[model samples]
Target: MDISKYIDYTLLSPTTTERNIIDLCHEAKKNKFYAVCVSSSYVALAKQLLEQTSIKVCSVIGFPLGSTATPSKVYEANQAISDGADEIDMVINLGFLKSKNYVSVLKDISDVKFAIGETPLKVIIEVSELNKNEIIKACEISLDAKVDYIKTSSGFSKGGATLTVVKIIKKTVKDSIKICASGGIDDIETVQKYIDIGVSRVCVSSDFNKKKQSI
Candidate 1:
């Protein structure tokens, strides 16, 4: 399936170091993965390391937790863009969504999308936090935000991406926003499953990093 281009090689830990990012980018360059996802603090470094390659530098805003205020997320997004981030993955306000306060949730994503203007925005809905209904509504809100992708998890939740959640998100977004299945995803089989079901991207982390190169 040429899964390499659909993967976002992620190193989003708080303790992630410059050396780690350098090595991660080097691996990404060699593997030709679609992008290298890192915390916003390292966007400049990643951009520098990947300057001459087609590999993209993706930065996360508000990260594993989406409780940050709208203004804060927007500020981070703007800073990332200024630092040369090619893509922005922002956590959605799960608290607001659970509270049935859809307005704030929509605003949070919309404001960041506006700040990062034209840069692809992948809104993480943290599927593990919501029940079936909330997941569907979150997808609807994301479609309205008009972001480029609707990502399933933050990889820090009790559970990560599930095929069930992916199916729901896929059926809901349906040709509107691209689906990004992350979290527990680990191998070629799961990756292919998500892609077959209409997911547009895969956020590969620990599982991908541990593999002893197949090529």
Candidate 2:
């Protein structure tokens, strides 16, 4: 299977530089990956570099930490879109979810979705931080918010995407929303495993970009 099309080539490290983004965009173009995922700050630069290419530009909001205020996430999402991001990936508020504040969790996601209009919004639940029940509840809330996708991780946490967690997310969400598995996804075989289980997209770092020749 040509997995390149299902990959969202990512570079979200804090120390990411302009030269790094240029290299990222170049790799995405050459490999024909589905998109290039970067921090909101580099959306415009990635957009400009990938101009005229089919590759989409995705920006992360609230990032590895989802504790940001709702309005702030909304503003960040809009700014990235205005800066030429094709998709938005926002982290869900883990604190609220743990506290069982479903209303606030739902509102946080819903507000961002409303702000972005039709632009695809993927809610990162940061699976590693939550238990089984928490994960399910988070998925349910994301569905209620009508998000486009439920991503597995932020890649900065204690752990990344796991098959068991993905399975739980899949069973909960069913076909209602797409799934994007990120963090520690460094091999093609592992990427194929997620795809086999119905994951729609996978966010891979630059290591996979250099390893694309094996695909």
Predicted candidate 2, C-alpha RMSD: 0.8
User: How do the predictions measure up, each by TM-score?
Assistant: 0.97, 0.98
List lDDT for all candidates, in order: 0.89, 0.94
> Which residue pairs clash in candidate 1?
none
* TM-score of structure candidate 2: 0.98
Off by over 4 Å in 2: none
lDDT over C-alpha atoms for residue 115 of model 1: 86
Write candidate 2's Cα lDDT for 1-215 as tens digits.
99988999999989999999999999899889999999999999999999899999999999879999999999999999999999999999999999999999999999999999999999999999999999999999988899999999999999889999999999999999999999899888899999999999999998876676665
lDDT of 1 by residue, 33-145 (tens): 99999999899999999988999999999987999988999898999999989999999988899999999999999999888888999999998889999999999999888
